[model samples]
Target: MNDVIRAPLAFRNQHEILNMHHLIIGAGPAAVTAAEHLRKLDPNCRITMLAAEGVPPYSRMALPYFLVGDIEPEGCYLRKREGHFEAQGIDVIYGRASSLDTVAKTVTLLGGDMLNYDKLLIATGSTATRPPIDGIDLDKVYNCWSLADAHRIIESTNEGSRVVLMGAGFIGCIILEALANRKVDLTVIEMEERMVSRMTNAPMGDMIKAWCEGKGIRVMTSTQVTSLADDAGVLKVSTAAGDTLDADVVICATGVRANTHWLDGSGINMDAGIVVDDCMATSAPDVYAAGDVAQGRDLSTGDYEVQAIQPTAVEHGKLAARNMINGNATPRGGTINMNVLDTVGLISTSFGLWMGVEGGETAEFSRPDRFEYLNLQFKDDVLVGASSLGMTQHVGVLRGLIQTGAPLGKWKDILLVQPNRINEAYLASAQSQHAALAAA
Candidate 1:
């Protein structure tokens, strides 16, 4: 183990000791993981986590199941044991961090309190994007991002209640599955041509669309919700295609935006998110950003991008913590941004830059009837991105290769020529990698 020790500053001759206090903003998975990693590096250092939400850091990804009551509230919690942070001597502050003074190394809370820090990490995640539609403020309209939103949706659902979801993205699709399981009359309206258009290609989208429709969930594609109205006790949604649907509740899963408004004028490089270098360090010294708010460089494209997934966020936090404690010995490189969704008996996985035409040639394989599809896009004979549906085993192999940027010349032939024959090889490679990492 590295000999990193977190300690407080010592005072001498009337000069206050400059204790190394790590102040982490946000209590999401990234912040929590960073805190734990920092503790491992420096057990005695002071660590404080400031969160806008009053609840402790929980699994936001599991909100869909919680909405349908498939999982209890406690199941969404990240910690397995009680008083996890307290046991570690880490302080958790329940309040919003309104502004950050990068130069002064201070953070201002919503209640007028300020805290100083030797190093600051901004991991404030993201919030769902609500579109500018008429009557959006009406009751029964909800956005699915927080635990409170899930509870509200769960409370609103009852037998025979009609629920309409806007946007057919991952959140929307997963929520549809959860609600359909409860026999809720569900309707999905998407502005895009197919479901999960951003994450998947057309074949995978069609597979999900067919599956959802087979489950009696009405899916509207290439449609836009122009306005929403309240008709007596029910809600009426008007679409751009001159179609109207009635519902008892509305859920919006349009998209997400990074929580970086507070740092607009704080001298931090801002694009779609706060820009950070490989070390997760901002342009200013002693200041770093991670998680969804940090626009770290994408290894595949060499461009700053925000990947709002829990695993990536946790990895970012761990890397940032390591850099901070180890005096920046190791370079903080980006990883493959991948996402997996298990919805209604279909497993879908995607990684890297899927849409861009620049990287390389693309290869595809599909079995529409069985809802199986695989698309590999390569650049300079190197695998860059892939989308797979109904092929869970193959996704694992592709994800490994993409992450390692391994030479796929030999593997590609086996994968493309005799895919089934190479299953054992894929499993062996994956297990070996896992074992090596565990040993290290």
Candidate 2:
């Protein structure tokens, strides 16, 4: 009788192993995209997503529009349809992963629930970096990252409110425009030498600073907030430059760090982020990482780096999902360094290695009077990178040319003389390539 009972239990355990489970630990675009693809590829597989925020998956990029009153909170949802996740059979569990056990293939949530998986994806994304400063924890000071934070900001801020924005990096600059729309007395402070120092060159940064000033927004570069204090029911922001400003709200957009703390001692190789191969697989077996958490290859530089941009995230998700199901059949092309900024009415963009590589040539044109500029970087006759200000016409062409790595032949010389003729060059180069292909 004992042997008969043991045989039945053993058979049930084997059946459970046959049913595959794909567990994703995030709720961002990458996470949702991967889940959807996984279901499409393997209809019978068990798909579960761990949403740490305990809310419906929403786009952080859309939060600014929410702040500007352009969209309702529901509009921020990645899938606005009712029962979207349910209809797709993707189970979303509202729990934060506290620890990962790669060998056991289990993740422990904060509430002490251990979930097992046949395969795992780490798409935990990132969190806003908060600098250590006195009174940094004071009331009304918040990082406008999540839905909860957005609610606090909306409640604390109003028209004519005194708002002090810290850091003028990519995230900060994005939030700046929404604040400006709120008609608040806004002041932007950056520790870098110029605005968006990492993404834009000196001339472009200066132009943005000047443009913001012209719009009546006080732009302070090379300035850092030293501390914050409560001043008669208002917030006091003290800067490193010996200046203090009183504010109704202090918005900290300092920076962001990858959400990889839970993977410590999990034997996963990580630099600034989890190092991923061409297939988006991590060092551990049966484990993958994607989106902002995975530092993969840069197509232009051929280096592994975290792009943290939406395009990169979405691409990473699709590639990761395909490879997960198809056994490394879909390797990533690479993640491009890309940014498109809209500061008030001025538009600026950068692609790939915008800050020219060594021994590379460049073609540039600028009309500071009209606040328009274009700079193109090249290696031999191929366009490698580009930057532009207040010009929308050449965006699609510039990206297409650089991404395709088209040989310009004589077009390179023409661009050096008249970089403004990028449109013509693109058309000619494309026609020539088509002709060559037809002849071949």
Candidate 3:
């Protein structure tokens, strides 16, 4: 933007990536992040955003706080201040991208119009999926993935209302906390043996479930929601165990799937998600993907994983924009599986593969009576994955060890004998890495 001239491609290898138009599909945090970064880099570049919903770009993560009345609906917006997009010269369209034509470099909207772009980014994010259970389509049944869902739940329920929640995953647990704060007679039903299966191991997850139940919330684990029925305006939820629970409202937070069905015939390398390289570019030229819609490599495992969390989305969003400016000039470091959760008053954290890998060693300590637990996974002498509850100081140390891949050496033996010495182990191991680097 500072005296840098951009122009169209006049030769096969010659290019002007900055002087171009960017059409981004989706208006979530990722889209907004990329748009702002692009504007800063190329002030005169044309940018347009498209989203299926009609609201301003907002973060789904903040919706839980909105339910507890801590913040108003407008507070959940990513760019809450008025005229944000207009001031940035970002043109927003409220429509779905129905298809893509890579050869023509145009995107087809649901309304039968095609939009052209010099570079296209798919940040459409993800959609919450509901299980194939009967009565899921009932009026009181809802999900917590969108802002509209939040409005419906808030409008329909009152304090002390009977509520049945399905799925105790990360998103579900957040909503669970909000519902508890609302004083709802809340009951949770999770198909997994415990809670937060994807983030923590069985023992840690079981402890979380116990902590939730101890808070006077009824938690049903290893259970299935068979069906639901509305009788005289009352919703009755039937479980697989032949038990029936009645509810004033049903909230489903089972899981989410990438919202990329519209790209089925788009000639993009499609799999469970859109295949993308470390640069965040798709198989096609000038077409990149990020957020949940992009299946990029996982740094720890080197496998393609969809991290639907907001931080990963924001990082990849910015990374993809930089690559768009220079044609994959700055490759991505890849994403890791990381999550920190606050269920009620309890704090939990997980990083990388919290569950120990094959032939990997593990160190664990637990005090079920006090709801404190920690598990560390090690491959050879290096810490690879970890999960913890009730320990805030361990958060940075755990991530640092896993990310730096520093050898634990003597510290590994110390952890296996007494995992509570996390701080000491981290200090010793980090110092060892520093000394080794200096010696070399």
Candidate 4:
């Protein structure tokens, strides 16, 4: 951490004397993970979790599965057993944080209730972004973010229901299968030139778009939704291309923004998200941030960035919790920017700097006819990034090679020539590194 005055201790624990009022904001994966870890660290710590949603702490990612009828509402919960939080001595309060007073060590809720804490964790995750479109606030327009949104989508969406999805980003693509499962008259609008333009390369994105279209989805790329109009109960979607489409429901899968507006005057540093050190500690003393709301380190770039994936959120929460009790004991090395999307039956994945860093070399192999593509990015002798489509077997190895930063040495040259030899390269590089470490 930073040089600052250490807060006074309320009591002494087995390891150290410390204040035990560990309060966590948000009820997503990060919040739940931190709360559980906090309990395991300090059984007697006064742990309270503030939830913006009225329902139980559940996985937002599971909302798509719920929409597909693969799982019920209960399956979306972080803790399934009755009184799980209570049994673990964790208090879950439903409220949105309105303001924060770092000096007073208190957080004011939207309902005007002030909660004081000795150690606070701001895991307040991201909120779904709503684009500036006319009639976007209409009754049928919903962002598939919360459980409530899922329920509304389930109720409104029926067989052959005309659903216009506004955005072909990761979140939008995730719910594509569920929407397809409903067999609705689907149309996906993307402002980019191809699907998942942010995550994958143009070729891979185009392949995904083609696959979706093959599945009977109307995919419109390089298109913009100009406005929306209410046609009685139907939604009239107007695009910048001067096209009007009738939709029963408009699912706004635009994107998400960090939930850090409340901390504006709180003096906490923020850049894209609440900036945090390796210890997950923010600029404020005794306050930490994690998950989508925290701008942590990216392993590939060594720069602070907000990784809104569930895996990163879990890691952030765990590390933040450990550091909270042990005083910045566990420093987060960095998080690999990765995303795996299952668009209908086709799978696409990207790891680390998938777009390839400046001065980096890239090896590509595309077989569009067979719906297969692979791109490997290398910097020096290290595998820094990779992207693959319809190649599920190498997903784990690709992620491992990028994350481990194993020196490929000669394998780098070999991979450049034969990109499909990723498995061999991973094994050779990892084994060499392991052998070297063992000898050391």
Candidate 5:
């Protein structure tokens, strides 16, 4: 339905002039998705995708479902149409890109082999954070970032086993549900003051902690594990608060750092991750980065942010492929920083500036007894952000309102008085827009 992507630079298709050799330095969904789109644009181009792990490409997000025994490993594969990569003439190499040079247009693998390319995609994703705790490398300690980690976790953890998880952030909370489902004795240690601190507001995070504690979980906030060591047949965890606990397994879900270590000497711009333009192009010529490794434009704030969510990764992958194929392709506008988390039985969501911007207004209502809450952020008359707990249906409207920058007019006043009328406000606003369009 749309044509002419119109990139910021002059461009040509790879197959138009010659068969372009494209080298991709990752095999996650983002990398695989890019390779597929490139194949569609140039059927005869040379495409090589490198996988840091030995196993087939799988999703780290699906690892939790696997831990809960909901699906097999194959279910985590991005595209399961057999031989998908081979069918597209894309070579899947198994190794890491140890070194790269933009001027030389080459990527040196760990084994000293080199691959020259016309375009390079850095989609190496991220790695689990190994906290600087004593005995953190013990056999029973693990992180749930890769399929290999999932395998180790599911194998070691069992029914009625003692499990101590460090960090109650998003990734940590996600695995909390799965570990609980396995009937393990779970205790969560969070350095933050509340759960999901980065995503939910203070009130909502406290509410979630209370809910989890009520659900028979031992949630310890404002706490840290000072050291961990094996004691006899169990692991002993020492806390910064001078407390000790024992566990059959210790999990470090502290968070993640982007896989940008290889770019230290590559002269690529980076803040939290690889800084890329709207075309997903890095500072280096013909070099691009996407997925969790990329720090791209944030639509809501108009700043660069790492939106590591799956949808953002898939979109980034496609957009990067467009620029790699034809430099004239349209640049990506940006991606919203959003998160919808399902922790055990409770659902929470945060979108845009959930922390509320300065000089802005907020309308929030909470029923702690009923496990329901809603907070709306407004800049002048326009919705800028929102956060909610146990309000699944309202999430869509909240995102819509914030994204569209809708002028609620009198509806804003109504919502401030009666927060429950959010659905009605959305409907009325939509109807008004439709009527205005019809009149036009």
Candidate 6:
């Protein structure tokens, strides 16, 4: 025989009440936007945002400009003022979420407290990945990912300081511009054959390399940094090509990795990132993930890919919030994956997969003396991708063409006849969907 404890009539309403607490696990743009959206949908809902970083979220994309002193600390902030999130009915917890209990629907904070919630959103962004090199933990070796890292580099920089930057990606190029502006002896070492190799094609890479060199920044390609040693007060960086460079500081801009360690043992599907469906829902019920941590589908390749850009993150947050509030809304379409690196005076923009050698034929126009190059890649008689260096006026047209999978018939003729004539029939057909949206 078992005795059962029943709830009293007065306490019966507790079981029927819905717990509308929304717990967001990050403080970056994605999490912040998601909180705002949730608040708009349900003003009385309990919204708690957990951030591993102590300070509130700031514009990390502007960190290079901040390092160059082009923008002050206050200008880099995304929030207009302090307590702005609080005014929006968001409770921010400045502590790392150590673990997740999916069964209990609770997040375990570092301080031995568990937050139970009806719905949870994992928007923990990414962290800079430091290469596994000897002496990488030296005091002078730094990674420019956070606001603190930017401050460290800015404080350590000087007129005659020799700074060795490892990796020549977008961030690396921006750092080169920032350091060169300070008149520092800047040397960039990249493992790739050319600068921004992963992002841009060969022609665009050459144009950017020339631009960097024109600004007195030494761009070293096909090189790998093997080790870093603190020689007295100076930092000695050894490269794989048997070359060594001395520097006052070493900035590693290799790349970033998804911050998903908290999901370990939480029964969430993760492969390099949190695996979410089209609606940004996790394997566990009522749990969602977005931003850099969520490996969403890529439109160009139709495969799950991690897009760590800010705009994609913001859009993902908005879409996730809509799906959460509306029960099951259609997932938003993926972005075309565009990157614009405005370093010094050079404006380099690359869209989609512009370097698929086997699947496409490339049509290029280059004015080496003018420092302008454009490469258009076509596959199956459709414009698949495009890259523009030192010229961006035609980027919008190219993006529209790529997004709509516009046919490449007579494309070369149109491009040669009047490059600015993007309002022609083919281009108009490519932008019909956008036109429809605008009309609506």
C-alpha local distance difference test of each model: 0.79, 0.86, 0.85, 0.88, 0.85, 0.79
Poorest stretch of ten by lDDT in candidate 3: 1-10
In candidate 4, which residue pairs clash? none
- Model 3, 279-300: lDDT tens digits are 9999889999989888888878
Taking all chains together, the TM-score of candidate 2 against the true structure is 0.92
Return the TM-score for candidate 5, rounded to 2 decimals: 0.91
Q: What is the lDDT of residue 339 in candidate 3?
A: 89
The residue pairs that clash in candidate 3, if any, are none
How many angstroms is residue 94 displaced in model 2 relative to the true structure, after the best TM-score fit?
1.2
TM-score of each candidate? Answer: 0.91, 0.92, 0.91, 0.92, 0.91, 0.90
Report the lDDT tens digits of candidate 5 across residue range 189-302: 999999999888788998999889887899999989999888787899999989999999999999899999998899999889999999999999999999999999998888
Quick one: RMSD of model 5?
Answer: 6.3
* Candidate 6 lDDT tens digits, 66-148: 88888987677778776677677677767788899988889887767777888899999999999999999999888998888
lDDT of 2 at 1: 8
lDDT by residue for model 2 (1-440), tens: 00101111222243356768888989899999999999889877777888887678999989988988999999899998987887777877778888888999999888678889888999999999889999989998899888889888888888899999998988888888788998999999999999998778888888989999999999888889999999888999999999999999999999998899999989999999999999999999889999999999998999999889888888888788888888887775687888888887789999988899999998888887788889999999988999999988758787777777789989999999999898998998855465543332
Candidate 4 vs candidate 6, lDDT winner: 4
Q: Estimate the lDDT of model 5.
A: 0.85
lDDT of 4 by residue, 1-440 (tens): 11111223332233233547888989899999999999898777878888787788999888889999999999999889987887877777777888999999999887577888889999999989899878999988999998998999999999999999999999999999999999999999999989988788889988998899999999999998999998788789999888999999999998999999999899999999999999999999999999999999998889999989999999899889999999997785788889888899888988998899889999999999888999999899888999999988857888778776788999999999999999988888875565543332
Residue 189, candidate 2: alpha-carbon lDDT: 92
